[model samples]
Target: MKLLLTSGGVTNPTIRAALTDLLGKPIEECHALCVPTAQWGHPMCGPASVRGLLAAEPSFRHLTGLGWASLGALELTALPSIGRERWEPWVRGADVLLVDGGDATYLGHWLRKSGLADLFPSLPDTVWVGVSAGSMVMTPRIGDLFVEWAGAPDDRTLGVVEFSIFPHLDAFPTNTLEAAERWAADIGGPAYAIDEQTAIRVVDGHAEVVSEGRWFQLTR
Candidate 1:
């Protein structure tokens, strides 16, 4: 699968262009499946937040509102009961997955529980567009600093990607570059700190930063 891991959604022309290339077509021609499961695990998220994503509210214009040919919700939490036969086709039919932000560990848990993780190997042509925790879920460890879900056993995730991510860099009072460095030290691994206008594109295990804002490699 192609990955466009971002702190924010596709916020700039460059990031959007990268997304288009990954889709191998115009955004208007692509079909998208949005996953809002992570929001359920976050203290700050609630019904209103989930509604915004589903409805493509103005604030979510960068993600769900990106004007795909069609958009549908694929709530990972519900997949276990529905059976893979029903949901698997839904996933494979979409051109991209627009995964929203919330709690990474929680998202990771449902991805496995919903049997979606098992499908990764079969989805070589799928484009994964992940935002914040959605992006962090691909890494090995998000560090305790980013773990907000009380149910998570530890600061760990799927580790689909080799490196970790420090998202929302400088967007919040607590997400300064110095804080990211400290977080990197706490985790002690290869990691990146990316601002709202930045993203990390990964394809076939190779990664490169696409940024119109600040970003840094925090560990050697």
Candidate 2:
């Protein structure tokens, strides 16, 4: 599977160009399945990020927005109002899954509870894309950032790729990088600390730095 793991939204024009180039076409040409809570505003029932990319890209034909599962603490609780049948088809037929940034702990919980963790692996052609919180979930464990009650009872993930991903390294004011380094030191596995505007492209289980940012693979 091809994974286009980004740090956050493609808000920067250069980053957006990089994303388009990596995908081998304009954003409009591909299907954008956004997982929105990857941002801070919508912690509970927010829309996915894929749609935002599509909306920003000039080439994309369809922009599919999947709302979050209600288990989160955010305010957008409209999924139940819209019903499941309306959302299932888009999710099932999606060619790409773009997980937006948000609270990783909460994102992980809702992913499992909503059966997305199980359903994602079954999608044969879907490419997994992540940014921020979306990127963190790709790891085996999550960093301590949320309220104590927000964490998942267990670490269950999509296992799309190996390696713990730490985003927003530059955003953290107090020793965020040091904290990530500590986590990597404790995990004793390949861990990446990516800055905003940076991304890692993993193809067939191999990862390479695709953007202009620092990517460190920690080793003891």
Tell me the whole-model lDDT of each prediction, alpha carbons only: 0.95, 0.57
Assess candidate 2 and give its lDDT.
Answer: 0.57
For residues 122-169, could you state the per-residue lDDT of candidate 1 as single tens digits? Answer: 999999999999999999999999889999999999999889999999
Per-prediction count of colliding residue pairs? 0, 16
lDDT of 2 by residue, 103-200 (tens): 66666666665556666555655566676667767766654443223445654445566787767677768527787788667666677887776777
TM-score, one value per model: 0.99, 0.68
Residue 79, candidate 2: Cα error in Å is 6.9
Best by lDDT: 1
In terms of TM-score, the best-performing candidate is 1
lDDT of 2 at 163: 80
Model 2 off-target regions past 4 Å? 11-18, 21-24, 37-86, 145-151, 154-156
RMSD of each: 0.6, 6.7
